[model samples]
Target: MAGLERQLTLRFLAEPADVNFGGKVHGGAVMKWIDLAGYACAAGWSGKYCITAYAGGIRFVKPIHVGNIVEVTAKVIYTGRTSMHLGVDVKAGDPKDQDRHLTTHCVLVMVAVDDEGQPTEVPDWKPELPADIELRESAIRLMEMRKKIGAEMQAHVDLQPSLQVP
Candidate 1:
C-alpha cells in the first residue's frame, strides 16, 4: 500500500436507481461502477486515457441493498507494455454497521491509447509489498484463465454451423 501510490477507493451510497425489483442492487450497475473505478485507477497509473480491453473473473459474493454504503477500490496490480491489470473490489453494507461485506471482485484489463485510438505504452509497475506481490501473481494467473476461456469460446463458435454465406 505504501509503494503503490496510484490507487483509488471510491465510497458512496447506492441509489434507488441502482436497485432492481428484487430489492437488491442490479449487477449491471455494480459492474458499471467497477468499470469506472478501474478506468480511473488505470488512467491514473498510465497517465493517459485508457480503454477497458477485457474484464473477467467477476465474483458476486454478496448482495448490496439500494441504500447500502458502497465501497469500491481499484488498483493497478500488474502492467504490461500497453495494458494495466486492475483489481477492483466492491463492498457494501449499512452505514451504521461496522461490517462491510465484500460484494464483488473483478479483474479489468485497461489499455492506454494514443490520439488515433491505437495502443500506446504505459509505465511498468513492480510489486513492492507482500500483498502487492500476491496481487501481481494473481493477475498473471487470471490472465491465463482468460486466455483459456477465450480459446474455448472461439472453438465453440467455430463448431456452430450458422455461417452459410450465400
Candidate 2:
C-alpha cells in the first residue's frame, strides 16, 4: 500500500529533564521522539487514531546533547487494510547549524483503529507519481527487513521447541 508524509519539529529547549541526563539526551528520549513523530505521520495519512504495532531498524547515529535543537521528520511509506509503515528521521544541532546531521532513523508499523478501538481499513496507496519514489523505496526496504527479522525469530522459536504438557 502507499502512504503519505508528515513532519514535526521541536526546538531543543522544549525538551526537559525527562530527556536529559548529565546535560545529554538519553536513548529512550530519542526513541520517544521517533514514536511520536511516526504516530503523527500515520494519523495524518489515516485520518484516524493509530497505534504502534512494531518498530524496527532503530539506529542511533549520534548523540544529542543539551541545547541542541532537534528536528524529527516522519512519513508513511506503506499502507494496508489496517496497518501503515512510517519512517522517522531525527537530527540535532544548533539553530544556526541548519545543516543538521542525521542522528537516528527507524521504521514503525501502526494500525488504524476506530472509536470503538477496532482495526479499520485505510485507503490503498499508489506510488505512480515521481514524488512518491522515495517513500515507495523506504517501504520496500522496511518490508524486506521485516521478513528477515521474522525468519530469524522463527528460527529461534524452532530451536527452543516447546515442551508438551502432561
Best by lDDT: 1
lDDT by residue (tens digit), candidate 1, 1-166:
2224568989999999998889999999999999999988888888788999998889999999988999999988899999999989999999998789999998899999988999999988998899999999999998888889999999999899897779
Count clashes in each candidate, considering only residues at least 3 apart in sequence or on different chains.
Answer: 0, 1
Model 1 TM-score, all chains together: 0.92
What ranges in model 2 sit over 4 Å off? 1-23, 128-131, 161-166
What TM value does model 2 have? 0.79
Cα shift from native, residue 110, model 1 (Å)? 0.6
Clashing pairs in 1: none
Task: Give one digit per residue, the lDDT tens place, for model 2 in 1-166.
Answer: 2244344454454255745546678888888888888777778788889899998889999888677778888876677789888778888888666778888988889899999999998767766767677787878777887889899999999999579897
